[model samples]
Target: MLSRLAAPILGIPRPAKRVIVLAVDASLCVLTVWLAYYLRLGEWVKISGEGFWQPQWAVAGSLALALPIFIVNGFYRAIFRYSGLAALMTIIKAVAVYGLLYASIFTAVGLEGVPRTIGLIQPMLLLLTVGASRMLARFWLGGVYQNQLRMATLPRVLIYGAGNAGRQLAAAMANSHEMRVVGFMDDDDRLHGHVLNGLPIYSPADLPSLVSSLHIATVLLAIPSASRYRRNEMIQQMRRAHVEVRTLPSVSELAQGTVSTSDLRELDIDDLLGREPVNPNLLLLGKAIHGKVVLVTGAGGSIGSELCRQILAVGPVELVLVEQSEFALYEIHQELLGRVGEAPVILHPVLASVRDRHLMQDIMRRYRPDTVYHAAAYKHVPLVEHNPVEGIRNNTLGTLVAAEAAAAAGVADFVLISTDKAVRPTNIMGASKRLAEMTLQALSAAGSQTRYSMVRFGNVLGSSGSVVPKFRRQIQDGGPITLTHPEITRYFMTIPEAAQLVIQAGAMAKGGDVFVLDMGSPVKIRDLAVQMIELSGLCLKSPANPDGDIEIRITGLRPGEKLYEELLIGNNPSPTSHPRIMKAHEEFLPWPQLRARLDALETALDATDLDVVEALLTDLVAGFRCESDTPGWNGTATALAANHA
Candidate 1:
């Protein structure tokens, strides 16, 4: 209670701080002269000489010379709250100015009998006394500020990175009575054993011992310039030591120059995965969709829905959502409506498919959407392998129809959502997507006004049917989570991140371009499943421990499955505005040649000739490959043929 009351007095706002500084300087001047006089004369000598007070004259002379010099240097203008390098420079100037003024006063008053050494000691004492008082004020006021707040019973924290950013954060939290900082943890060995402000720096390697000894509940990450992967690694290490985690925002967010406790946020669960950061091109993304009528097909699916959310921030005039699924479409439509309330953009959720060319044409003519993001397709490899005709129909023919409609409607851009599986595809699904890419490329070359492009990437984390969600569900069920093969690995990204990159790529596309997202190092399926289990605070059930919480089971690879996925079809991908997205320059068929292939594929589909359609699809898609048939594969092919017949 006492400390709380003392805070305001000690805080010393700008006006008060200046007054105190000037008072201290003036007072120090008088004290120095008196001390010099006593030391030189060897007694409390009276200054009166022939009924004139000489010592009084000397005291008055010192104040007159020193006070104006201190004021002129603007020493009082320094804000203690923002004091750092600049503050140090101001102090140096104040000392120099006062020293010169004091020397001049002694000469003018003819007090030349005073030892010259007294002049030297006076300036040193004045600088030390004044500077030391400022430091004391900071310490007292900081304590008072902390006591004012009603703090939570959180554990003491030690932040890593004790540079300018760290020091500022520490100062901001000085009055934070709730979470006390014991010291700083830094990688610089030189910084070890040095005290910053009042906190000591400890080596990062000693965190385990420090956390245990200090009983720290949390460790705040203040290294804003650290790479995302590095930050994740540090956070994981901290988590292993049984400490909770938090982080300061990126340096860019604090460019305006103040670091506040409000900007400190709890570490997100996603940071534990050690994912690399993505740098996006804001201008390129804004150029294509900002204030333009944009439509996303399959707008309810994982990729399509995320595209809608990201595009909303790009300031589209209208966002037309076209989807065949009623529930999925309704969910995204409701979400968007809630977020962009009363904005000029229209969020029209139309229940339609790209296969319905007549319906698509009508909507296109009605809306005249400036850009269309075509994400509608049959994506599951095993499912598409079983139902090849539907796969080819939706993916291959659907893309053809969408591209043609966009061309007829004079749309500005058309982006086909392609897959890494399309590169040297090992499944019918991949082969079909490759055919779709070819269709768009041919259309773009054949005098289409619209800029046609395909953005290819692999499985996104947390998407429907993705391994992460499936593993999560299996772990929840307290049993075995299945994996296709221990060796199977694929490129992964968050759904929103992938979708954002896709939109950015679409915005950068010219005619007949294929953009591949830079999905950093692929993760093995078994390892990913294991990490998910462990992160959920569960142990793996195995021969070593029968009572373990989760069991991982390996299922043989399904048909059309590959051990790994690739992003580019061939060599030499050109870079884009964003480092994470690359444009693949591949050869394409002429309009006439592609048209003939489509006719053949249609005939093969109508006749229920599985072999003919497979051959035609392979001939059209360069570097096409398929895994050997499995039990599910054979059964599905037979059923598909019977249905067509």
Candidate 2:
């Protein structure tokens, strides 16, 4: 109740607050001077002898001189409730100067009928009293002590670094009532057992004991400069302790030299993956987009949208977003415009599917984009497997239309976003993307000015088809977190990293280059689920722990889903200029042969016979294997052969 009342007084207007502080200091000056006289002169300073104001001239002069000195030294400018050591030091300096000046004047005037010793005694008394009063206000009001008052409710947190970045973070959270910082965890042996900001610095090995004793529930990673691999190692240790973990923004992301509430957020899964990104090659990144007209197909999709962002950052002359969905198109277009506000890039949003050949050609002729990043495709595996004809029509035929149009328009660069599933595929989505890659390869082989290239990587971490989000949603809904298979594993990369490598890889293209990204390592689906649940401070339900918060349920793999995904069709990839990308020399059908097969594919697709399309894909795409040899598919294959015959 008392703290609540004090809050309003502390929150008063600046000028008013200063006036109140000034008045209090002036009264304290008179009181300290009178006390000084009473202490030094026994009978003369008695109330009956001089009425405590006998030295009326001295008390009046003290106020007249000391108030101006205190005001001049910015004593009142330092808010009483928030003032610190700096303010205390300024008070001492002002009092010392006042004493010396007053003593000099009185010496020349022979004490001016006042006690000589009062001048020396008063300065010392004033310094002690005034300085102490300022600190008392800070303590009484909601300053650092406020954090102490709410320590019972606030979660005890431990900071994970003791370096410069860690210190800045500590300063920001000094008076925070939401989380009380218990101590710091550092790897440096020298810092162990030492106190930092009133909290002990513990070694990494001491975290378990400290967390247990201190009842710490959260750990904030303040090592902004730590490598991803090192940070992940620390997080794994934290997870073992069953504590929630978070992190500060990276050094580049933090405001020049400060940390704030906005700079702290939950640790990203990419950080846990421990893949330290290689710095992008700026020259290669901008080679295709800088000052050139750039067009992105499926520009509103996850990968496409990120490509637009990176392209805009590279100073493209004009950006054309070609998306089939109207809402997705408008959303991305608005987001891009807002991000690049007033920037000199001309943005054009075209709501036309890549399957529309005439529209694709018209866009090509209208903009004549120097670079076209083809990101359009039906990527959902089960959905594409169920509707193979439309999948191939949109993915394969769409790429054909866009590639042919770009070639005819003499576009300088044509880059197709391919997938790891496209390699030795079993699903229609993968096969469609493989066929798209083949189309780009064949277009380049046909001797066109457009330099066709494709960048192949595994599943992006948060794309529309990512299993991560599905598991997250299921977890949020509270129940069985479904896993397709216990052994299923796939490569993962953050959206930004994949987009960056794509632009760099595309720019390095000599001709039809199949650039494969170095998708660090494959992560098992089961392990990923377990890690996510644990890091969220939740336990998984199993035979051993039947009362866990989240339950993991396994469902049989869907059609066209594989236990593992491969990034290369063959193992003969040569390294590119960039460390994390490679160029693969895969065999592609010549335009003459591929063109005839495509024509037959169109005829088969138009017939609406699923079996004929499957047979065509199996025969045309090398290394393509059927996920199932069900008796039904065999019967359909025979029927398809009879009809073709």
Show the lowest summed lDDT stretch of 10 residues, model 2.
Answer: 43-52
Q: Tens digits of per-residue lDDT for model 2 on 52-113?
A: 34566667767888999987887776575336877777877888898887776554454545
TM-score for candidate 1, residues paired by index:
0.63
Q: CA lDDT of each candidate? A: 0.79, 0.84
lDDT of 1 at 554: 82
Task: At residue 331, give the lDDT of candidate 2.
Answer: 97
Model 1: per-residue Cα lDDT over 492-579, one tens digit each: 8888788889888988888899999988888787876666665454577889988877888888889889999999878899987788
Backbone clashes in model 1, listed as residue pairs: 146-175
Candidate 1: Cα lDDT at 7:
55
What lDDT score goes with residue 177 in model 1? 57
The TM-score values for the models, in the order shown, are 0.63, 0.75
